[model samples]
Target: MAQQPRYAQTPTTGGAPAALAPSASSSAATTSTKIGDRAFDKIEKTSAEFFAITYGALVRQMFIDHNERADIVNTQLDQMGERIGVRLIEEYAARSGAPPCRSPAQAADSVAKIGLKMFNPQRPSQWLQPPRSSGPVSSSTGAAIGDAANGSNGGAVYSISFDENPLNVFVELPDALRQTLWYSNVLCGVIRGGLQQVGFVTLVWYVRDVLRGDDVNEIRIQFQGKERETFKVDMQK
Candidate 1:
């Protein structure tokens, strides 16, 4: 029989037991009836163990398909996330009734306030201040990922922290493959793809991961600019 995947057994904060603090305004009652809440309610609740196993299997398959190549796996994971994000944004916008974000800070706030709150245990307190602009920014898939942490459009960076990562519930990474596998990199792609639908171009990636043993799990995101399409036209030579 295959050895069952090992889970980090330590009791940690986060997961489904956490409650969302309702707004204090009188309209709070009305807000409670909003689409996001309704949608969240309709979601099928499942054990983290199950989610972990299922997600793990998917990742394992990808690794196998790619001959356990980490870089390719990471890229594939991000693409998958971006596709999900593209769809998720439409769903979120329609359900939450959130207005279009005007700036990076506003976008980050909505991502934390509505996006994370409804789905995960993260709260607004977990959001870090947007990174300040100083120098040239780095590219996403190149040496820039290791260079200045600034973004493209006016160099604004935003981030959120997660105390408990459901995906990591039953994960035990082999020492040799730890750096090779970015277990949650899909989130970076998701954020990038989701915001792209709303007219924002961004570069998102994990600055930290609990599996890698960082203080609090963090994802650092940068706002690049608006995505544009180019077309070819026939002209007299």
Candidate 2:
């Protein structure tokens, strides 16, 4: 029997983001109309079934390659993510041309709005991922909108809360490595690595995980410092 689609019955309350008009310089745009349109059009999403298996194999290989050291695996994953981030910024700018974010709150909002839409656009509204930076609040008395919440001191810190991770789709950690493994920790590195290119140095990490039986998955990003000089050099490179 054929399996049901994971997001078939999923609600789509949030409106789709308006496509960023590609500028003349973005050769990638010439190849694909929109950042997500290619994936949306050609590939039949596998309900993440094959993704889980392939990702599981990768983790297993990493374990053998590293001699079963969880710390080394985690660090390796982060470093790999960082390299991806360094390149991702260039692609992101080419596609979106999102201006330099002024504060941590703004950066978090952009990550939730633009980043998710580019990568995980097809997820259901049940995922509670916001369509825009100004998403709905969870409670009537809430102070913030969507998963992007500004901290008490304002721009110094913020959190982007969400329920699903594209990488962690249908993942189940074995009991032997449950406590030691941060299954999706590479994401933290991605955020840190990508943002650093844009001049914002940050501390990014997971606060909760569904793999750990948490109700939600959240990533907290804290402002560290900004380097305009090096940022320009990195962008030029």
Q: Quick one: best TM-score, which candidate?
A: 1
Q: Give the runs in model 1 whose Cα sits over 4 Å from its true position.
A: 1-46, 130-153, 227-237
Model 1 RMSD in angstroms: 9.7
Candidate No. with top lDDT: 1
**Candidate 2 structure quality by residue, lDDT tens digits, 76-172:** 8788778877777666665554555666656665665555445454321221222224333342222332344434334355555666566665456
In model 2, state the lDDT of residue 147.
Answer: 49
Clashes of 1: 0
Candidate 1 lDDT over residue span 82-149, tens digit each: 99887777656655666666666666666666655455433433555434542222222222111324
Off by over 4 Å in 2: 1-51, 122-155, 229-237
lDDT of 1: 0.62
